[model samples]
Target chain A: MSSVPLPSSRPALGLIGLGAFGRLIAGPLARHFPVLAHDPTASDDSGIEGVRLTSLAEAATCPIVVLATPVAALPEVVAAIRPYLRPGVLVLDVGSVKVVPADVMRRGLPAHAAIVATHPLFGPQSAQDGLRGCRIAVCEVRGDRSRRVAAFLRSALSLDVILTTPEAHDRDAAASQGLTHLIARAMLAMEPLPTRMTTRSFDLLMQAVEMVRHDAPEVYDAIARANPYAEEVRRRFVAQATRLTTDPVQERDRAA
Target chain B: MSSVPLPSSRPALGLIGLGAFGRLIAGPLARHFPVLAHDPTASDDSGIEGVRLTSLAEAATCPIVVLATPVAALPEVVAAIRPYLRPGVLVLDVGSVKVVPADVMRRGLPAHAAIVATHPLFGPQSAQDGLRGCRIAVCEVRGDRSRRVAAFLRSALSLDVILTTPEAHDRDAAASQGLTHLIARAMLAMEPLPTRMTTRSFDLLMQAVEMVRHDAPEVYDAIARANPYAEEVRRRFVAQATRLTTDPVQERDRAA
Candidate 1:
């Protein structure tokens, strides 16, 4: 693992979203990078120290541009900033689902600018304290830039970088995260529970709730309703339940 | 909270089952009671120190009797011990579900012996070190004897006693424990995950597995197939899942 060298002169960093997750990363990253930030919802003057809140055109002046926008807003955000990106500038999107963002970047970003699509498999809750020990899946859309960004993440953030294609990332996530949140919602919907119950199982469910509870509704909606592969995983889970119920004997026999 | 008063002279205790749970309680209780144990699987010499393994006829000599057997075996065990029970002997069955055992004891036990059915709501894993702070639900069939046993558990074991009817105890168990174990098994069946791949949700699932993992096959069978109210809870859970899948928009709208 190559260490991300602290450049003698910090590279200019541009952040294009300022939601909870975007704000979380912006504060820490500004300490190392000269950051220019832009968020339509946030006032132009609103940004952390060392971060200059600027216009999309002004923010794109940086060598590294981060699309921290919501999944639904990514294509538009990418389109708005693409023309201003200089040659050799690294353009990256930190989103949950990968394939769509990767495609948007590949088609929309200027040919000169390097585009890398990645999913940091955690949220604001996990990143609220810090990003240590969390896994980040890097979908290499463009060659050397993806490796460079992954290397920077590994060395600077101490993140465990998993290299995989965007399609594979979405498919694996359909089971790992998509199915998990779905099950959690199902558990909460099953029955009304007393606030005081402290069984270990209940505690675990509460932990899952805490992980996804404060996420933007758009995140869940995108994963559940928009991710192409998620429905197949959900169908498989329901089919498993149906098999267990309808032909329990056969299920037991198959297990045996 | 009545403290368990140490008997001045050890009362003879009759134990009618010697499974893992039965053995755990029997060994400790023998130090305080002149224990007379009867289990078809164990010979007369199989009991621990201070416990006299004896025939069903000989076990009748004790004033306090405990039926520590599986739910399926409880009916036959209750019948065999009923004729031999002496008057005033407090007979309690420590089973997971209370309604059936309460009914069995009420219908089968001799009028002279008072039946006090209880569900400890915990197990060897939860209490492997000691029984302190655990919750025990006492379904009082015979008032005087039920108070005595509840008082003993509260005082001696330092347990939290929840006084409830057998019907209510079973109903709660159908949701809390039965549904918990069922969901756990479903989670386990979904993936053959390596221990190294543990997430918070997977760890929570493992905790559930650990709670029910040691249970006898008969225990699961009884909970899944025998508990009269459990099937209804399972059906309701499935219905809830179907509704979530079919009408998520309405559900989310209602939640909002």
Candidate 2:
């Protein structure tokens, strides 16, 4: 309900990763606080205009540092930044699945430093028009910083912030993101799908299919493997599909 | 490219089934020609206006009769109307699958009755905004009368008409319609799907799922079994899903 009260002297917002998703939020985030980014893979921040390029150590010491690294790289990134993190520095992770990254942050970061796990549900593709009204799942791990961040997201970015535990967020996300990517990948494997004379139902499926078709293979893997609930959901989906296809009596019914 | 030449005496368009789907097309068809419909299940034509209630024989005798009966009841309806169809009378079918219904018309109707198989891709739910710009697959079996009907559909009804063979239509439809319903039914089987915090991709899947969830079981059966190509498509889809879910390495890859 309350807005994120800006500090009298605004501190630089640190961004640890500069991948597609990281760059997407950088511009908007830069508007609120001066952004300083560090990406080991990039030689320079030529593409990202609004944010300044800085070393990992410099970015880590900022008042608010966002860890935007891949899920598998979380532990190493957390360890790398742990020594440089100053007391009361809020370390936020933008991981798709929160539980593991939240755990990694807790284990690596010092007790003096704050940790928060957040997943902005929209990507560049889904948020092409804008990020207003987008949903962002927030999991407050070790501080009251989540309230300030949630308020900022709601008031400044116009985001729908759902405050939840890391476990609940991953459970719900496993079904949503997991099943979607699985279906999209499977559909792409069945390419040259009939383009003409598509019914509205088939068209809707195709719309979803096209959205995630070009996603990185690693994204697919993470959703399928990292999220504890994904495997079970995938198993149940496949099992249902198998049962429906094999049933002879069910297939023999006449169409309306 | 040409408009249907309106005859000086506009003969009434006969509709042989007055179900929900039948009633959907009745209002539009009545605009071109006075519509007289007959349904064994209906006591009167109270729900749909612009269509008069008539006996089966009277409806069958019209210059243009649309057979909107269920796929299972097509044979009996064909036999019942065979005696009433006069020479040069155009008989059309609005069935979902073309092959079986086309064959039914060819085998049961008199040689003089011109048969045209049409599958309007949109149903009552999809056609709520009206039939303009909807896709309709047409397979002309026995006459040139289909050309006139196609022109009428394109010009007067503002329909996108795709002229195709019964075999081709059924083959493409098996993949399109079959895959959609299969996914919807399977998703429904996995009930209590997360209602909140859905991604765009997941929301699109749910939209397609909601569209077909209330469809008749017979419709599902017909698409699954009646269309010869549906089984092969279903088999491939299930096999792909199975392989993806089972591959451990694929699931373990880290997301970018």
Candidate 3:
């Protein structure tokens, strides 16, 4: 895929949500783009300069509009932006689960507006590092303009872009993110935090805790409970555990 | 819990087993102490000096004898050294499980020799950087002389020592070592090795693989099978998994 450099004219960039993740992205993107931000909850850009806090209609005037709202707020935000979106506006999302948002963006956006569903794998916790060497999943790139958006994300941010359909993204993520967080939560539930530990096992559990500790509780719950493919992977992990207990010899043999 | 400083005249240290872990300790200990090493399998020391090849009886002549044998061979080694142990000698072991070797040393050794069971919570692969901050469990220290041994391990080797009974050591280790290695083996068995992975989950799994990969199959089997307390902890891990699947609400409630 051919990558496009960041636009020379500093294209107007609209960010719809100003939560932790949206703020993180907007703070950095403002330095390079003429960022027009809108959030019902946030009044102004407190520290980020060169960013214009505008209404939904005014923000929609930008060439690239990013919907950084949570999955629960995505449908409403998509409906509100649909009427104001310019014909060739590049609309993208940063939601965790892609299938629902992809459907909403495709159904609600103007016919001429390009809908691109992208998930930046790292969250606000890692945003300060500047997205270098991180992976971004590009799901359901519908138009020629969407390809350019993906290429810009790759070239400008130095992100490793993996191209996959929305269904595939959700399927793999069910195991990779959803089930991992679920397992970590399960481990935390099983025992009290260790008072003293030094073994490699304890170190692994600590690593899991560190990864999921600061994530939004709702985000973890949605990933675990809402993703359709997550239950199967959870079931598989449970089955593996059962085999370890009931028929350990068979478990050993299988592993062997 | 008084500790004695290491004597100016460090005694000859005897290492019986030459497996990966035993060699790691023996090679390094040989650097600091006069080491009498014997392995039925390994031929060369790879140029580590001050190591004398000797029979078990000749090695037992040292006032401080370390039984770095495998768990399965520990009883035999204890018996072999029983006849040669001199008065005031300190017989210590480096095994994953404690109760069995502690009992064997109690029943098999001469009354004049002191028996101390230790579990250094690291291995050759994980301890490659040296045992600077690693924790070592000293189980059922017998005599005043055992303090000198503990001091040498702590002050000289910079190991942190946790004092506990053999039964308690086995109980904790069954959960810590046995369950950890079991889960790692299970995870490794489940997935195909990724050609390229950057996610934190994959990195955690890779760390688990690094910790357990070089372990002897016998060591894995011994941890999984020999410790009687292991089955209960393994059952708890499996139960936790089942609760996550069959009743996630209960799991989340418990976590809360």
Query: Number of the top candidate by DockQ?
Result: 2
Candidate 3, which segments miss by more than 4 Å at Cα?
Answer: A1-9, A247-256, B1-9, B44-47, B193-198, B247-256
Ten-residue segment with the worst summed lDDT in candidate 1 chain B?
B193-202
What DockQ results for candidate 3?
0.36
Candidate order by decreasing DockQ: 2, 3, 1
Better structure of 1 and 3 per DockQ: 3
Instruction: List model 2 lDDT by residue over B44-138, tens digit each.
Output: 54366567778888888889999987887899999998888888899999877889988989999998988899999988777889898899998
TM-score of each model, in listed order: 0.84, 0.93, 0.87
lDDT of 3 at A17: 80
In model 1, what is the error at residue B255, expressed in angstroms?
A: 6.6
> TM-score (0 to 1) of chain B, per candidate?
0.88, 0.92, 0.88
Ranking by lDDT: 2, 3, 1
For candidate 3, lDDT tens digit of each residue in B71-149? 8787788888888888888888888888887888888888898888888888876777888888888865567655666
Q: Identify the leading candidate in terms of TM-score.
A: 2
For model 2, the superposed segments whose C-alpha errors exceed 4 Å read: A1-8, A248-256, B1-8, B248-256
lDDT of each: 0.72, 0.83, 0.73
Q: Candidate 1: which docking quality band?
A: acceptable
Q: Write the per-residue lDDT of candidate 2 for residues A37-63, one digit (tens) a residue.
A: 889787765366557777888888789
The regions of model 1 sitting more than 4 angstroms off are: A1-8, A44-51, A127-129, A146-148, A194-199, A245-256, B1-8, B24-37, B42-61, B193-199, B209-214, B246-250, B253-256
